[model samples]
Every structure is written in C-alpha cells, then in structure tokens.
Target: GRNEKISAEARDAILARGEELGQALAERLPEVEQLLAMPGADQIEVGKKLRGQAQPLIDEHYRTVLRLKPRLAPIKAAVFPLKRNHDQLVATAKEVRRRLQLGSEMRTVYDDTGAIGKLYRRQDEIGTPFCITVDFDTIGQGKDPALAGTVTVRDRDTMAQERVPIAELESYLRDKLRG
Candidate 1:
C-alpha cells in the first residue's frame, strides 16, 4: 500500500511538471510555421525576447520539484521484522528487500541449530548490513502477542542487537538505512 501510494504520487508530480514545462516551451517557441509565416513578424521578435526572460522561471520551477513530489525519490530507510517461522521470515524479508530495491537474492537455512548464528552468517553472505529479529521478548510483558510493540534489531556487520519499540520501527529503519 505504501509502495503504491508513493509511486502514484511520484508519477502525478512528474506528469504535472512535464505538462507545465511543455506548455512553457510551446509558448516560448511556437511552431516554425507560426513563427516565420505569421503576419506580425515584429510581434514574433518580442515573443522571443519574452521567452528568453522566462528561462529563469523554468529553473525556479525545477528547483521546487521535490517539494511538489517527495514520494518518488529514493527511499531513505527500511525496517524488517524477522519472524520465528522460516517461511514467514523469508517471505517478509523478501518483500522488504524488494520494496527497498536491495537486489540481493534470498537464501534460507534448514538447520535450526544455532539459528541466530545462521541468520548472522546469511546476512553477511547476502551483504545485508542489518537484521531485526522479532522474538518473545518483543511480545512479552504479559501482553498479547498481537499487542507486542517491540523488536530486536541486529547489525549484521557488528552482530549487535538493540531493543527498539515497534512504533519507531519505520523511522529507526530509515535512519539506519540512511547511514
């Protein structure tokens, strides 16, 4: 849903900007026939001067394009929760990787012995810089599993884990990914 919304917003902004630019260019440089064969050649000369002066306006418009369409830009960050079930985690991870455009192939390990260690190894093999494991601690505190609001994020390179609240997952991932 986020991906779809972002893409739509980006496309609309780009199309609107393109239309504006096209209109400006058409007004500035009319068809060659219109410019050379029109009755008022003197007016054409004035139009050319006016168009030259509008160049600055075009530049200004381009500068503010980001403000008009922010969703289409490259993602600044991403967050993923590693579920216990191998299939679920793999599926979720694949989706996150796809959404982030990471371009890495997904790999799975069948052995549960030292699973966390295996995950760390896989992360290194795939060049993933960070991994987050959603475990019992995340859903603890005598709360319902559905109500759990915490996750354990691990740095692939450092093998360090940190407890982060689920509510901050997006921003947290954004910051880590940006880094």
Candidate 2:
C-alpha cells in the first residue's frame, strides 16, 4: 500500500537529480578522478567535501520541497484518557479516537498509560499535532456544567489547551490540519 501511494515518477526525478549531482561533483573535483584511478581509495573525504559543497543545495531543497513531506508526520493526533484509573474517561477517549478514524484517513493513537504530561511528551516526540484528553470535564464531572460533552484539546507546538465540544471535534481538527 505504501509503495502504491508513493509516486514512481517523483522517486525517479529524485534519483535523476542525485545522479546529476554526483556527475557534476566528479567532473568539478579532480580528487574524485584521482581516487577512482587509484586502488582501494577511501571515499570518506570525498563524501565530506561533497556534503560541505552541497550544504546550500540541501538546505534549499529542504526549505522549498522536502519540508512538506507527509512521511515526516508520523501521527496526526493522539487521544488520551486523563487517568487510566477511570473507566468512563478511558471509554470516552476510545470513542473519540474511533470517531476521528471515521471522520478522516488521518492517523490517531490512543494512549491510556502513564501521567498526562508523559503522554503529551510521547505524542510530541512522534510529531502528533494535536492531543485530545477525555477527562472528567468530558463527562460532566467538572466545576462548569458547560464543559460537559467536551474534551481538552491540546496543541503540541504551543502546549495550549482549549475545550472543544465532542460534536464539533472532527471538523475542528480537519480545519486546523488543512493548512
């Protein structure tokens, strides 16, 4: 499925560019030719020199194209129960994850173990953009009755928390992820 999803033409283009770079380097650098003429010549120094010379090219490519690569994004979002001790919180979190799966093809992870902070860090390490925590407020056990049927949505980058109603969670997430 992964291979089917990847564009063969794009891969070929990348390979072609790499070949061009190698040819250009071999032509411009006399040391490369000398290394080829000699027996058992180490290419490590050549590699380092090439890397040094190609730094600008690599940076430009990453800035203009490679930064947008979707494969870099491992997880779209992670769903978490505030505490594993509570059955209702765990159920709500699972339901939220299920609903997210139904809404989009985005990857979602359900984590229920460890403290909420550690879970958030784990999701962050995986490059998860958002985290939905189903806490007591999600099921009307909070100080504010208005928070019922709402989950605490945390942004991975900013570490900002916002209460989002469960009904609008799917569209809300889709909108945030669109750009």
Q: What TM-score would candidate 1 get against the native?
A: 0.36
- Which ranges of candidate 1 are over 4 A from the true structure? 1-114, 141-148
Model 2, position 77, has a per-residue lDDT of 77
Which residue pairs in candidate 2 have backbone atoms (N, alpha carbon, C) closer than 3 angstroms, thus clashing? Answer: none
Please write out the lDDT profile of model 2 over residues 26-58, one tens digit for every residue. 344443343333322222343344456665454
TM-scores, in order shown? 0.36, 0.60
lDDT (10s digit) by residue, model 1, range 1-179: 12332345554444344345456563543332233333332233343443455544543333221111112223222244345465554454444445434432222222223456455554455455555555554545335565365666676545578876755655666666545
